[model samples]
Target: MTTGRDILRVTLRRNAGAISAGTLLLGLYQAAETAFPIALGLIAEHTLRERELGSLALSIGALAVIITTVSLSWRFGMRILQQASVTEAHRWRVRVAACGLQPVAGDTDLKSGEILTIATEDADQGADIIEVVPLLISSMVAVLVAAVALGLADVRLGLLVIVGTVAILSILSVLSRRIGTSTREQQARVARAGAKVADLITGLRPLHGFGGNHAGFLSYRRVSTEARTQAVTVATANGVYAGIAQGLNAVLATVVTLSAGWLAFEGRITIGELVMAVGLAQFIMEPLKLFSEMPKYVMTARASADRMALVLSAPPVMAEGRGRPSPGDDLEVEGIVFGGLRELKFRVPAGEFVAVAAYQPGAAADLAAVLAVRVPPEAYAGVVRVGGRELSDLPVAAVRERLLVNPYDGEIFAGTLRSNLDPGGTGRPVAEAVEASMLTDVVALHPEGLDHGVRDRGANLSGGQRQRLSLARALAADADVLVLHDPTTAVDAVTEQLIARNVALLRRHRTTLVLTSSPALLDAADRVLVLDGGAITAEGTHRDLLATDETYRLAVSR
Candidate 1:
């Protein structure tokens, strides 16, 4: 359904005023250039032949005026066109990013790296259509003016130039179609190669130990090689197309020059007219070449627009809502029937710390999705409420404000340690959150303490360090309800116990849920619920459940 013409039409509609004014100025510039040789021909035929001083001076002044017009018009016209192109490109790039960042996941087949390519390179090329339109119009204006001037001197010359140009363009147009197909293929291949590199970089450390890096390299190399092959195919098509255009252009120029000479030898035109005809014939070559190159710009813009449209046209997966509940911290899930959950239900009063251990591994993620507001109401048979109101009725932003569902291995951005912990500086104190998450040693490891610079995505930090920092960042948010899924997966047993104890003490008055089977966190919880066979089958304090229920003991120990 995405024809890619949508982006092109929208871009043109928004910049209509700018394009009109810029094209007018550019047309004037091309007209001025066309007039230069005509003025010389007139001065040579009248002023110099008369041998009169006043006429020569006037002719020189006229030539100076024409030169000044050419210089000024070209300078200002290009400035306006270039500015519009840059601004339009920036606008599209930001629009693409905004679409990708929406809280409700969109139904898109594009991967992360492919989206990045579309937002940056594809946007930039598509905006070149703005510049291409004006330039193409100006080139046509130059050719039209030249033909008119030639016709005034000799009718055959004008007809021949126009007819020959049409013929050459018709031939080149067919070759350009082949170029368009190859260029589009080249763009897709490059995007796939980019996706491979992004995947490899994301898991670089883990991949390095298991020869995954080598396997990824082999995969990337194949994609890269395919991209290069497509690039070569595109290059071959363009070369053949340009070669034919130039060859035809040279033949047309040569024929016109010969015809003008024959007419002069037959005394059919004056000497000055012949000079003008020859000069105009030579000058027309540039405008004709401009005609030949326009197809390449059109093809590139169309291909980029197609890629951008893929991202922009993706469908949103959740309903748009603006409803919110009255303020409270109570969490409730009743008759929740989702994937693998058969009427699963649970509740936690305000200021309670609870741990959920699921025998079925996927059960934990199902619970996280419900609390995180990731599922659409129409897609499931359940009602999840916070503060006595349904989650589906509330705006996604409002839900996020009330409950922070920190995912496993949460993302880390490039910044100082303190900035990573409290990015907005609106959360709980950095020292307090860091201490509670057992990240005190990380601060001490760097002499600058919280000021220590962290690499992008914590690439320079160990997995355990990244995990603890993720925990610390979430702890600082001060949300009404907090859920941590497998927060201690990467840490040692001793460190996990300390983190559980400190987190429990720091969040004593806040509602918190730990969705993990880690023994340290489970034992530290005020109460533990065992989820098995798609429902909560047993519930008690961790020590009591361990002694009383064999299923709870086995599941937690796993």
Candidate 2:
């Protein structure tokens, strides 16, 4: 597990060369800027003392060199630093995205909106640390070099510059801490607001149909208002900090100028030295301001990095199995006790069509999850076997390739119908799956047929259409064992009947498990298991169970 500090260290190490070059160039630029006023003062003194044209030309030439160096170094240094910052952001974004995609144990309690914020906004903030270090080093180098040059010219003036800079930074550091706290609160509020909006948008159609749109709107508005208030508070703090920084800088510069003027008036320092003191005093303001803001950047970057580390360091939910699954179609659940399943035992032979009618909704979902490998084996006390081999001992990839559990509410990505149906480009003939899933009517409605555009999460399609499309995609996988949970609930009775018959015929020689309460699907299966009270109480053909078991009859009737 990596901490925030470890992440920062790794990032710095990765970009060490770029950081060093940028820091060196920036420091040289600051040095050259400081030299300008000193050169002017020296030229003035030389003119008054020697009155030599040759010496004047040489000083002017040196001033030009300093000006050129300042411009060139500043331009190149900023380019390098900015590019490095962008690259760092890109790296963090990719890492966070990949981590989010992996299956991890336990609940992360992170919504899609929060994950989006971390990958985008928080990633940029984490990358800002790249610039903060180099800028701090360069600013300190400038301040130190300026102070030394001033002291070399006149001891009193140099002492004033160093003492004033220290006082200003001390005050600003306290204020920056406050800013950091406020920024964290602001970011959290914004994330919550974004999450609320995303949820509302995803369920907009349902909310509107149920006449809950107005209530949902009020909820979103409340969260949005809170985020707005936090943002305002953050902005106010930043404004106050900026004002204080600028005002203090101006006051210090004024004091330094006045002191230099008094020394020149008293003939304690030459005219050139007095000019250099005033110039150095004014020039130090930018570096002082940069130094004051470094603490705030550092704090923000630490917070963002910590958020990123939360995702990156999450442990996997289950240890991966090293063994591959053996070739077989039989699936056996022995003495299974997890969630709503209590000492459940069942077996489906090779090339058999089995249906499980679970009365409890939670049991149905939990059973589906167990079959899909969504839950860790450690969470349950059971032995699930395929081809006489334990599922826990088989590699996840091999199990997934052989057995596919299509949940009732599967996801539909944004793309063409054809792409969604055949994402792997397996070239397994989309027409057969579409026909078996009874989606031919949907494909025929659009001129583009399989190429018809689908919105995000199949928003553009009807609920029934989306369900059929999801079934079609699962069928296209051509897995040896297919488990479907209520695959025809969204469609009408006629469509459901057609889909059930078509699926039975299409997968006649394959092992299939259907967990549903629908009569059409249950009647189509070769065997039906009545699951109740965490156990299978009865098992037989669908018609036999319906006639002999009252509980099973009532469950399928609804």
Which one is best on TM-score? 1
Runs of candidate 1 with Cα error greater than 4 angstroms are: 1-3, 103-106, 415-419, 422-428, 447-451
Top model number, lDDT: 2
TM-score for model 2?
A: 0.91
**lDDT (tens digit, per residue) of candidate 1 on 138-225:** 9899888988888888999888889988998899888877887888899999988888787777678888978788888888999999
lDDT of 2 by residue, 366-402 (tens): 8888888778888998888888888788777778888
Window of ten residues with lowest summed lDDT in model 1? 100-109
- Residue 491's lDDT within candidate 2 is 93
